[model samples]
Target: MRTLLSNIKVQVNPKIYIKDPETSVLGRKIIQESIILIDEIGFDSFTFKKLGDRIGSNESSVYRYFENKHKLLVYLSSWYWSWMEYRIVFATANIADPSEKLRKAITLVTEKIEDDATTDYIDESVLNRIIIAEFTKTFLTKEVDLENKEGFFLIYKRVVNRIVDIITEISPDFPFPKSFASGIVEGSLHQHFIKDHFKTITDCNDDVSPTDFYLHLATFITKQP
Candidate 1:
C-alpha cells in the first residue's frame, strides 16, 4: 500500500493557491520549510518573510504560490485531508465487516500520525501537528462561507463524509451519522491537544489514546459487537 500510495499525488484545491506548490522545486521547498516553520513557531506567528528566510527565497516568491498565509494554510490542510482520504479508502477497501472498516477509519483519523516517506517534500507527522494545532484557524474567518461555497474545504468534508458513511452502514437507523462523524474527527484533535497541554482534562495519554475513545463511542453508539 505504501508503495502504491507513494506514486499518487495528494491533490489540493487549485483555488487555494496561485501556483501549485507541488509543481516546482522552489514551490515544494516553500511547502517543506513552511510546515517545519509553522510547527516550530506556530501558525499565528508564521509569516512569508520568515518563511523566505527559512527557505532562502524572497518573500515575494512565496506569494507567487500562495496569496497569503491563510491560503497557504488552507492548501496544507487540504493536502493533508486529501492524503487522509486516500488512506481511508485504501485501508477500508477490502473489509467485509462494517464494524472493522469503521474501526480502521476511526483509527486513521484519531491516532498519532507518522510521516509518509512517499511525499519527500511534505512531512505528514509535522503537518498533522499543524492540522491539530491550527486547522481551525482556516475556517474561523469571515470568509469561511464564501470559501466553503468555493469548495476550499471539499476534501475535509469528504473525509468526514466517509466516516459518516461507515457509521451509517454499521447502523442504518443511526439518528445522526453526520454529527457523529464531524465530532469524532474534530473532537479527536481536541482530545490530542488537551492530552498534551491540559492533561487534566482528557483521558488520552500514553496508555490510552484518542483512537480508543472514539472506537468505544462508535461501538456504543452503533450498538455493534
Candidate 2:
C-alpha cells in the first residue's frame, strides 16, 4: 500500500469544484482544513468562513476553490471513494482467491482508519469519520438529478462497480452482484453510525468488531442463492 501511496493524487470530479484545489497551495489548504473543520463541527454547522479562519485565509479566497460548502462536501466524498478504491486495488492485487479478495475489500471498507503520513495534506482518519457521519448530505438533495448527470458520484459508483466485478468472479451465478456490493458498502457505513449514536438499533455484540461483522455479511450475501 505504501508503494501505491508514494505519488498518488486522487482525482475528484471537476464539476464539484469551482477551481482545481490540487493546483495551488491555498487551494490545498482549503481542502485539508475544510475536512478537519467539517469533521469537528459537522456539515450543518460548518461554513466556509469558519474554514477560512482555520486555514488563515478569508472566505473569498476559499470561494475561489469551491462555490459553497456543499460543493466542498461533494469533493471530499468523491476524494474518499477514490482513495478507498485505490486501497481495494492495492490490497487485492496479489491475491488470486476471489473470496480472499472480497474479504480484504470488506475489511478495508469497514475497519477504522488511521492517518497516513504519505498523504500529509489530508487526515484520512478524520475524513473517514466525516464519511460515516455526513456522506449522505452529498446526494440527498433536490439537485441530485443534476449532480448525477454531472458525474458528481462517479468515483463512488466506480468503487461499487469494482466490488461487483469481484463478487461476480467469486460467485458467477449470483443474481444481484451490484445490489449486494452496494449493500455491503452502505450497510457497513450505517452500522458504524448506529453503533456510535444509536446502540440499540444494531445487533452487533460488544465483542464483535465491525470488520468481522461486515466480512460475515459480505460472505453471506455473496454465497446466497
Best by lDDT: 1
| Every model's TM-score | 0.98, 0.95
- Model 1 TM-score (2 dp): 0.98
Candidate 2, residues 110-135, lDDT tens digits: the string is 88888877887889999999999999
lDDT of 1 at 161: 100
Itemize residue pairs with steric clashes in candidate 2: none
Supply the global lDDT for candidate 2: 0.87
